[model samples]
Target: DVAFLLLTFFILTTEFKQPDVEDIVTPSSISKSKLTEGDNTMTISVTKDGRYYFSPTNNPSQRVELLEKMGEKYNITFTEQEKTAFQNTQFVGVPVAQLKAFLQLPEDQRKKYKGSIPMDSANTQLVEWVQNNAKINREAKLAVKGDGGASYDKFKVLFEGLRDIEFYKFVLVTTEE
Candidate 1:
């Protein structure tokens, strides 16, 4: 009885960490170095279908603050409820212009939305998002999680977007081969 109780207590107390971002098959590299997770790290994911998602950190308040700053920069206003929804969001893939509508959608509908922030020469929402987040957290490190099947052009666009903001240093998240 005592051993069973101890086992149950330990099992109940154990914390199981789950991946907050969407699952994407990352490219493999020979390097065995692992990426460390921290509050100062920002992860940007590119899905195989070319959708982009951004997450500054796992902290809700920091994410909200980033969203607020972005809103202020673009002259887009977010309500308290919208701010709360954004705070609870894991990775936002929509452009700032559509963020209000995206947040207003039902959770299931939002998940089904396959839109990504435009990265074209005329549309530089992704670049603006990265720049805004960097301004909010000066010490934050940028990491890119590109899908293994993602096209080179997509990555080129991403690199160009970063270069536009003079952000040359960033880590490419890959798994050991």
Candidate 2:
């Protein structure tokens, strides 16, 4: 009974970390540096298929707030349900213009939609997302996680998008080999 009581107490007091945004096979590196977890960090993930996902570490409220702000800027109004869905979403990869439609899909469908956010000169939604988030919180640290099998051109586009907004400093997320 004492062991059971102790286990229950510890479980109740411990904080659980959120799961990773997606299962990615990150490129390996020899660096031993560890990533610092905080509410002010933004992780941008690129999948093997060139899809992109943006997530602010440990801050669901901030994600929802960003969505709301973006909606207002684009003259798109999201329902409470949509806002809640955004909060629950681990990462956002859809364009702002299609966010409403994306949010309306079932969670499973949203997960299955393998579309990448456009980061070209003609379509600058990715740049706008980063710029808006930076405007809201200038101190937010940025990190890019690219899959080992992903193309370099995808990353170049992402870098160019950031450069357009004058954000030149960002970390690359990699695993120790």
Candidate 3:
């Protein structure tokens, strides 16, 4: 009787709340792979235009800024090492650090950091260029699914962007058929 009374009290007093969830759809792939579940893991989508969109694993509604955020967080645009890497290759894209610094600076402050009275419109264009191309389209775990038609070059850029953000384990979405 005593145990039953305690159990009743506990049950009555306890509060239960269901967590909110979002719907995320991933495309299937033929290759075998595993899903990574976590709060930090993110799913990034590489569009045909080379735009990237990503969301955290647990919360799909939370939109990620993708490259600009990464470039800001990792200081990729200002780092000397990234600059050196960019200079070494001709076809290589802009130095990650340069991009980061450009993105990090405020519109008005860019001129001060850039060391000139009149800001270079070209540099400003580059900053806008970075922000314009990246976007988060949907809510889902950063678990990425790609169509077979996804290009290798575009994929490489996506990979580099992921690497820039320090994500090593990615849940590659695929189908059995």
How much does each candidate deviate from the true structure in C-alpha RMSD? 2.4, 2.3, 15.0
Report lDDT (CA) for all predictions. 0.82, 0.81, 0.40
In model 2, the Cα lDDT at residue 43 comes to 80
Error of 3 at 17 (Å): 20
The better candidate by lDDT, 1 or 2, is 1
Candidate 1 per-residue C-alpha lDDT over 1-177 given as tens digits, one digit per residue, 9 for 90 to 100: 999999999999986653635668998899877788677788788988887887776667777888888898789999998988887666678888889999998776766667788787788888777787887778888999999998888899989989989999899999887
Lowest lDDT 10-residue stretch of candidate 1: 15-24
lDDT tens per residue, model 3, 35-145? 654544444444443433333333222222334344565464334443343222111123334454443444334322321111122222222222222334232234554
lDDT of 2 by residue, 12-123 (tens): 9987865555678889899998888577888888888887888754467777778888898899999999988887776678888889998989988887676667777688
What is the model-wide C-alpha lDDT for candidate 2? 0.81
Worst 10 residues of 2 by lDDT: 55-64
The prediction achieving the highest TM-score against the true structure is 1
Model 1 lDDT, residue 48, Cα: 89
What is the Å distance of residue 23 in model 3 from its true position?
A: 14
